[model samples]
Target: MLDGLNLEVPQGQIISLLGPSGCGKSTLLRVVAGLTPAKHGTVSIHGEDVSQARSRLAFVFQEAALLPWRTVWQNVRLPFEIRNQKSRKTIESALKHCLEIVGFQPNDWHKKPSQLSGGMKMRASIARALITDPEILLLDEPFAALDDMLRSRLNDLLLRIVAESQRTMLFVTHNIGEAVYLSQSIAIMSRGRIAELVEVPFTYPRSSELRSAPEFAAFYGRVSEALYRSER
Candidate 1:
């Protein structure tokens, strides 16, 4: 249902799509992830069409959706289970690095999803996404299910991960505060199209303190204005 939607996400930046529910936010992420093919338009990653560039992308959904039968280590290693060309050492190294990036402790590795807290499960999900070391990461409200405090903690963790990896990211979220806190720019969508894009003129290392800053309020107002206008 995307209507002539055209967006250019810059390299190595976190850009968020903010819109009401069912306004094609998730649809847009799915399209970009190559999960849902676009019939009329082309999706290109790094100048190559999706079909040719899919290997360079990774996606994380709101729900961790880990297999109930798998342990944390097994869940994070799920992507590698499908391919067998890699040596055990290489796979172990990749899993170790991705797990550390998402702050997974060694003790938590053998635990099942039912044994882990909600946040821990999502952390495992993120580790699974990062194990591939994708160039472009597409997230569809990955932290939306968590409570406010947990969500903020995860947001900080995500920012650290993004800064460390420097991967290009396209994040979809309905939370204005999250969009403002996490993205360098916010694309406001309404009625199946992008209504506007607003740049958040803030530097990196932004914390919860930024939420109380005057500049943060100004940017929030600007994005809110765009969102309000989109529904008109």
Candidate 2:
């Protein structure tokens, strides 16, 4: 059972859940997405309980999760299509905006999932998540498959998207450095529970300079210590 997960996720901020592999970070995201049963806690999004917050949340899984049979545009359009809704010009505009923000060119939208590289596929996955205009986005190691350079690029892309959309996000990552880079706050999980929640307290557009900042080193130390203690 998940124990004592109480914490505040400020609206329009990005909070990452970080832990080692085999920890329950992804499981937490799944539960928050309502894909699995949340045993005892209430999830609130925008002051509304999420269990009752239907049609208000979006989930982006790792592995792109795109359908091979569908082209990229069709795949991104699934949220509208699944609800028996027609795509509006406004909706297409939103999709195009999201794709452009994630660095997809015009020709990229027509390609199938199989035609895209790992990074492109993940970008398409992100586009699909944002297309619905979700207030809260749950991302599960969405860039883990890409190389370090690509992952850093996507990290910047993700931060830009978050800024543009002003969407709150719960990101799950096994990478410590990435947690510091992308998150304003971090919940370090262990054994189905959050061991510590630390605020980053850094300003937005967190530059590469922060990597050498004293605050950065201090926060990293605290997170490392928390994880080490959680293991015992």
Please report the TM-score between candidate 1 and the true structure: 0.97
> Per-residue lDDT of 1-232 in model 1, one digit per residue for the tens?
9989999988899999999998999999999888998889988887899988887888998999899999999988888887553688988998888888888899989999999898999999999989878899899999998999999988998899898989888999999999999999999999889999988899998888998899889888888888998999
TM-score for each predicted model, relative to the true structure: 0.97, 0.92
Candidate 2, 58-126: lDDT as tens digits: 888888999999999899888888876675887788788878877889998999998999999998999
**Alpha-carbon shift of residue 140 in model 1 (angstroms):** 0.5
Best by TM-score: 1
The CA lDDT at 180 in model 1 is: 97
Per-residue lDDT value at 112 in model 1:
94
